[model samples]
Target: MNVMKRIAQSALKKTLIVAMATGAMFSTQAFAAEKVYRLKLAETWGANFPIFGDATKNMAKMANEMSNGRLEIRIDSANKHKAPLGVFDMVKSGQYDMGHSGSYYWKGKVPNTLYFTSMPFGMLPAEQYAWFYYGGGMDLMNQVYSPHNLLSFPGGNTEFQMGGWFQKEINSVDDLKGLKMRIPGFAGEIMAELGAKPTNIAPGELYTALERRTIDALEWVGPSLDLRMGFHKIAPYYYTGWHEPGSELQFLVNKQVWEKLPADLQEILRISMKTAAYDMYIQAVHESGKNWASIKTEYPNVKVKDFPPEVMDALRAANDKLLKEHASQDPLAKEIQASQAAYLKEVRAWTDISTKAYLDNEAK
Candidate 1:
């Protein structure tokens, strides 16, 4: 399939492209009347990181093309910004007009921010997206970020992430004890409960950290982006995912900067971001299937394992306890958690009956 042709044929692309052509009819006069707006974005990933970085590029390209040169978005990766995890703070302080990062990165600063990203045993992308757009998840998210001078939107989805590449097989919960891993967000907290040492490592440094024994095991997404990182050489055991069912990335806009945009430009930017987010999810599915196939054919030493039932139960219990503790301390956290649980229960019923049932039947 021709990617450009497919995009141009999309409903969104057709609308915006027609609008651009229509505006051209009034070009002579409108050219002088239209003011160009330029914005700078800071992303958490280093330069040219796959999937994550591609989302930013796609968003920028769509915005520029849709707005007909009125809106220009320039991205600065971690190397340029020199602070991968500081995207939220920089965007909030107006140092950058926008940012591409994960919302869960800010949980330490704003406890409620954690819920915006994927949750352990939470709703998948489509369901969580339903919660965001239709089920008031977006409103709740703004309630968390608005006070901080930011507007957060879904940047992209990495789909379901693999558990992690481990140095040893996890036959039981005891196997996790004293294990040093480079996992992050609330998932790291849960690991800490199980006597494992969990730390956050920047993407550029993940390979070196794991190789040099700075961290024993790490989960840096699944095969879509992971195969390129060469983790299989260091850790032979690949575990299936239980945490971060659908890892959603985030795009942050400075509230003041957003309000300054013309209504048409704002709508264009919003649609561009939304389109890119879903595109990333689809792209991940394709990349993962291709890369995992390569791994099976080319890498015989790599081992795949799911956490044993006993270990899974322990993680679930810890997740519940931590969530309760967080909810009790913050009313907003409680509301968000309740909203997710309710939405998950509502959506997962259909998911099981439809998608799950289809897949299981096809397998048989």
Candidate 2:
């Protein structure tokens, strides 16, 4: 009987060992099944483009570190993709899993997109950020992007854009007549309304265009980005901005690809993008101050001017007319415009009191 009991005990031990080994194998398989997801991102900037490219790189790095190898993102700049303006279409069709480009660039393809970027005389950066996060801008953005099978997020801010680098000063509204400028989006429409010939040129070709008088003026970001373009050397007049008060770049994600990410990884990506966007804004501010100081010190010949009161009035009138035309055509456009107008009114008051007031007081 004792011998029988020993044999039974041995059989039980072997059964338990088999069960434990099988469980371990299944656990390993489960872990393996959650393999690293690789995604491709296309950007609208050339390779090694300064602040814009850095934003994407930083986002990818953060995502990778947070996911602990579960997610990987590869970025292809305009140099690699050779489709700077086609980022929207490529991401929509899933040819690229993500994209970094200006949302306003899609105005021709998606009219509502214009509202999400900076409008002519729009809210400043802080106010716009508040509107985006707290004032229903994100929901409106999602509504606009959802039909395209893409998700949109604020990629970064260019702070307050410098008006443009001009060969001649804009002294009056008459000076805008027949002026050839390379500007894009709604601002270009506003320029055209004011009788300026607005053209769109690739960033890589902007300097050559300006130098050769192919375009008389161009607005590229601010000192943060424009300094590197060497525009200060060719275009002697630097105008203060009235358009694109706070330009925001966008991140485009293929909805299908975004959906495929695990819950944890999705959170990681969202946080990564948000953090990177904020970081880019801060970096841009730092670079702008540094580069503007350099430009003033090194290129003292560059004249800084603001649009005259008459020119400002004409531009504002044109902007109002065009916005009205847009609103009249599409209900969604009207809704967005109304939202922006309301938000801007509410926020600009505080900005005037808080920011403008301080500056005015300090200057005095």
Candidate 3:
């Protein structure tokens, strides 16, 4: 009976040990399931930049949902947490985990970065999206950012933009001289070359600057955003198709932070950006059409004019010269331009046959 009691006692001890181990395992799994991370995201534009705000909020929302609340992002607009132009470096240095801004904002740091934003007389929004996603443009962009300890993904895009809102008419190249213009990136440089003083100002400050006559001209996104900002009220002479042909925005992540993310999460970010990029482009195109109509009806005094053919020709020539000068100064600039030109050749062929043909017929 004692021996039987001893065996029973031993069995009971073994059972307790197993139960304890199982409990410990369950506790660890539960702890891991509750793990949470918070990331800081920044953008150059204010909350009013529709695509920037919308895409960013969408990304944060999707990430939270997918992660089951394990990951949360806190977004801060320009000067909310950092300066607008400082975003790229902040993300690169891990001061901020992520940023959403125009690639052109960092032209001083990376001259080739402007290609990701827009190239003068370059591809439109749809074509830019195709080039970046499918034509290996993103890979080339990564190459440019790699040295800076950054990883960039294409974010929202602003489709074809208006030439600008000018206080005075630009009938010829000579008219651009000595004009204090608020522009950015290669466009700004081209303006300076053409004798305009190109100044960089945040979107939020644009309206007041134009109102106070601090700037002679301003080029914001398009009619929709411009109308909302009341640019037409100040500069009634609106020109089309000169400065920014197509503008693309970007999502930049710190290389270290990006590398640390789970493979699946990294892919989720890329896919989300890719989807948002195209969606935002379409949204802008649709909104611009509606906004143009609204502008004509609401603001009868605003003069809407197509850029004269001579003006367009001169600007195009200046753009080409500016690009050549940039390529000469920066090897990366040359590389990006080469890639873009090559990809555009292929894209133009197909687009000319299909999309352009359809548009031309519709115009007639």
Candidate 4:
């Protein structure tokens, strides 16, 4: 009996030792694998620039929390970076691991970037989102950015951008002639075609430019943001949106930095950006409603005018002509235009029946 007991005890001790050794190996592996990644983002907007800046901040916060301290993102706004329009180049060169800006701002650098933002008479917010995620927009966007060593994602959406708070009303095609406006991207080209001198002024300088008569008219955003800028105080002739029906901002990532992230952290970052983007869209709608109400009551003297049919006709003609001319010059530009046009045609049909029909019914 004593001999049998001794042998059993010896065997149990050996089993325990093996188990302990195996657990130690796994613990060491885990210790080695667990890594914290820190990333820096540069944004085009000034610090705490409301809806736009909020998106970046929210994205960073969510990424940190969701990754359980594995991922840390630090954001530097235009004020800190001192380069509002340099986001694309910075991210592409790895100076910034990430960037928050509008894709359209990079049109001169990459023509395909123009199509990803709101085009003239383009799809609305929901429609454009569908086109991006479902209708090959993301793939097309990637096609445009990958060669540049950057990855672009839809950062946020400001539903409908107003035309401009013109110092004077637009009544005819001739009115656009010799008009100096602060516009950018495809719309700038269309305006140029119609004889308007369109230039891009940074947001911080827009008010001073307009006030000093450097720019005759300018479109910043809609009531959601325009109120804060005090555009109505000087340029009260607010025009309705014909350009940038649904303006979408962008997030850019350095390809090398992206590849450095673990699969889980990458997913967390992706989800964080998308959620914050959606939140910005909703907040824009909310702010517009509230501020628009205030505008109607408090700013009764401010004139909210739509461009006359003749001016609209001229714009559409110029838009069509410029698009054809520009698209013909670049194969990629042609492809992007074709995709947006096709997606708009398909999505607008459903939109007419659902949203448009509902709104039409409600307006009565």
lDDT for model 4, please. Answer: 0.89
Q: Please provide, for model 4 over 1-364, each residue's C-alpha lDDT reduced to its tens digit, 9 standing for 90 to 100.
A: 2456547656755665676778733343343234679899999999889899999999999998776666789999988999999999999999999999999999888877888889998899999999999999999999999999999999999879989889888888888899999998889999999999999987888989999889899988898999998998888698999998989999999999999787888999999999998999999999999999999999999898988888889889989998899889999888888998999999899999999999999999
Off by over 4 Å in 2: 1-29, 32-34
Each prediction's whole-model lDDT (CA): 0.91, 0.90, 0.82, 0.89
Query: In candidate 4, what residue range of length 10 has the lowest lDDT sum?
Result: 24-33
Each candidate structure's TM-score, on Cα atoms with residue i matched to residue i, is 0.91, 0.92, 0.90, 0.92
Candidate RMSDs in Å, in order, are 6.4, 8.2, 8.4, 8.3
Off by over 4 Å in 4: 1-29
- RMSD value for candidate 4: 8.3
Question: So what's the TM-score on candidate 3?
Answer: 0.90
lDDT of 3 at 1: 24
> Candidate 4: deviation at residue 138, Å?
0.3
Question: 318-350, model 1: which lDDT tens digit per residue?
Answer: 999999999999999999999999999999999
**Number of clashes recorded per candidate:** 0, 0, 0, 0
Positional deviation of 169 in candidate 4, in angstroms?
Answer: 1.3
**Candidate 1 segments whose C-alpha is farther than 4 A from its true place:** 1-33
Residue pairs in collision within model 4: none
Pick out the ten consecutive residues of candidate 2 with the lowest summed lDDT.
24-33
